[model samples]
Target: MIEIKNLSKIYKDEFLYRNFNCAFEENKVNVILGSSGSGKTTLFRMMLGLEKYEAGQILGFNHKKIAVVFQEDRLVEWMNVYDNVAFVLKSSVEKQEMDKLINKALELVELIDYVNYSVKDLSGGMQRRVVLARAIVCRDSILFMDEPFKGLDDELRLRIITRLKVHWRENRTTVFLITHSQQEGMLLGDIIYKLAEKPVKFYKI
Candidate 1:
């Protein structure tokens, strides 16, 4: 479990979260919800140690393996589909096994046909899927995803979300997904956290 108490991050005139507090259960899907600039992603950054909070307590599985998909695809344009996934996998993967998982991940994201294709050649949605598949295939215990489905169509979103839910369930991995939509947040969240500027509130949605 991860516990955060009285956490705060401030820069100049901006305050990400003041006296923020929460606990994240292990092996569960936790959704962080808010409109733009509501400090949801800011809080995520704090949790990931990307930004330092002024004052608070944050405790979780220390040195736990983490994987992320930022709002941007973050894919290497020059790399082929398989190589991107292979990058994070080297820590615990053999060449042949990595190849197998890359294929499995691409297929899961409906991009198996593009396995040999360069990321530069893929469309936005297709690249998003590849990014997602890369993160998911990391087989990490904790995942942080920021707006991974932003530009996806309804059909693609549902399909990818369904596959993600299934994969997470099978592995019992802990997940933190940040999104602006209530619908998207509620779809796969076991717990929902809402962020606001003045007073942050969290509840089961």
Candidate 2:
């Protein structure tokens, strides 16, 4: 389990979090639901150790491999779909194993047909799937996603959500996703946390 105790952060003159406390259960899809500028991204960054908190303790975060899907695609525009996913594993796996994993991830995202296409050439939704494939290929113990389904239409979003559910069922990785969509929470979250007005109240759904 991941625990946050007395978490606090300040942005400019505003208090984002003040003595906030929450816990994320292991091996489940945990959703953080909040509006823009409510500090949902900040909380995710703090948990991932990508940002610092003024005063807080984040337990169960050390020595664990973490994979993240940021709001932006963040793909290498020069690289093709296959190479983009392969890039993350190049340092850790042999060429044969890397190809196998890349193939499997692409298949999972239904992007196998476009394997050789450059990331810059794909549509927004396709690029989003490539990002998902990249994160899934990592097979890390923890996954963090921020508005992962941002630009997709409803049908595509639902399809991707179904695929993600299957992936979670198979891998049982601890997932922490933040989004403002209640429908997404209903579809993907095993445990949902709603971040209300500041001093930041967290309520379970």
Candidate 3:
């Protein structure tokens, strides 16, 4: 389990989170649902150690491998789809193993045919798939995603989500996803956490 105990964060003298606490189940999809400015991104940033909080203890992540799909695609525009995913893997991984892993991820995201295409040439939705493929290729790492399907059409989005559910079940990678859509929360989350108001409160559904 991952625990956030007595967390406190103040931004510009405004309490974004105050004495907040929550725990996420391991090897499960923990989807966070919140409106804009409800501290969803802030919580993710703090958990990823990209942001600092005034006081808190985010436990159970020590030395664990972590992978993220940020609000932005954050891909290397010049790199091809396969290379982009491969880029995140350790150099110790053999070429054969790397090829197997990258191909599997691309297949899961329905981007296998675009493997050699540069990210800049792909559509926004496709780029997002590349980002997801990258994260999932890190088989043992926890996955954190923020609006991962923002640009995809509904049909493709649902297809990918189904594939991801299967992938997650097989890999047992703990997932933390933040989305505003109730459909997305219901579809992807094993446990849904709703965040609201100042000093955000969690309503587990």
Candidate 4:
């Protein structure tokens, strides 16, 4: 379980949050819903320790082996799909297990055929899937995704959502999905958190 207590961030004149509290369980997806500039992305960055907050406590998590899909597709331009998935991993997984994991992850995103293709050659949605593959294959208990399906069409979005739902259900991985779409959040999240101008406001669905 992940516990966030009194997590607050202040930048310049803006207060991202203050006395915020939330709990992410071990085997479910939780989403933070807010409009752009609502500091939703910053919250995730702070949780991942990518950015620091003014005051807060994050417990039961380590910096190592935590997989994330940042707001951008931080894929290496030159690396192919398979290698990119392997890139996030620190330890050298055995060949057989690594192969199986990679294959399953790629299959989840429907990118198995493009495993060897350079990420730059793939479309934005496809590249996003590669990043998804990397996060899913990390085998982490916690997965953080920021606006992961922003650009895809409905059909593509539905397909990826379907695939992700299965893996997330089976793995029982703790997931944090940040997005503007309440519909998207409703599809996979067991609970949804809505953020207002600063701290958390309310959540339903």
Computed on alpha carbons, the lDDT of every model, listed in order, comes to: 0.84, 0.90, 0.90, 0.83
lDDT comparing candidate 1 with the true structure: 0.84
Each candidate structure's TM-score, on Cα atoms with residue i matched to residue i, is 0.94, 0.95, 0.96, 0.90
- Pairs in steric clash, model 3: none
Error of model 1, residue 81, in angstroms: 0.6
List per-candidate RMSD values in Å: 1.5, 1.3, 1.2, 2.0
Alpha carbon lDDT at 169, candidate 3: 83
Cα deviation at 182, candidate 4, in Å, is 0.9
Alpha carbon deviation, residue 101, candidate 1 (Å)? 1.4
lDDT of 1 by residue, 1-205 (tens): 7999888777666665678778888898899998987777877888888987789888985989898889888888999988887889988988888888888788788889888899999888888888888987787889999988977899878888888888888899899999998888888888888776555556556
Q: What is the TM-score (0 to 1) of candidate 4?
A: 0.90
Candidate 4 residue-wise lDDT, 1-205, digit = tens: 6889887778776766888888776678888888988888878888888898888798878663566788788889998898889886648688788888999989888899999999999999899888888988878778889998867889978888988988899887888899999889888888888887545544555
Pairs with steric clashes in candidate 1: none
The alpha-carbon deviation from the true structure for residue 23 of candidate 2, after best TM-score superposition, in angstroms, is 1.2
Q: In candidate 3, what residue range of length 10 has the lowest lDDT sum?
A: 134-143
Which regions of candidate 4 fall more than 4 Å away from where they truly are?
A: 62-64, 199-204
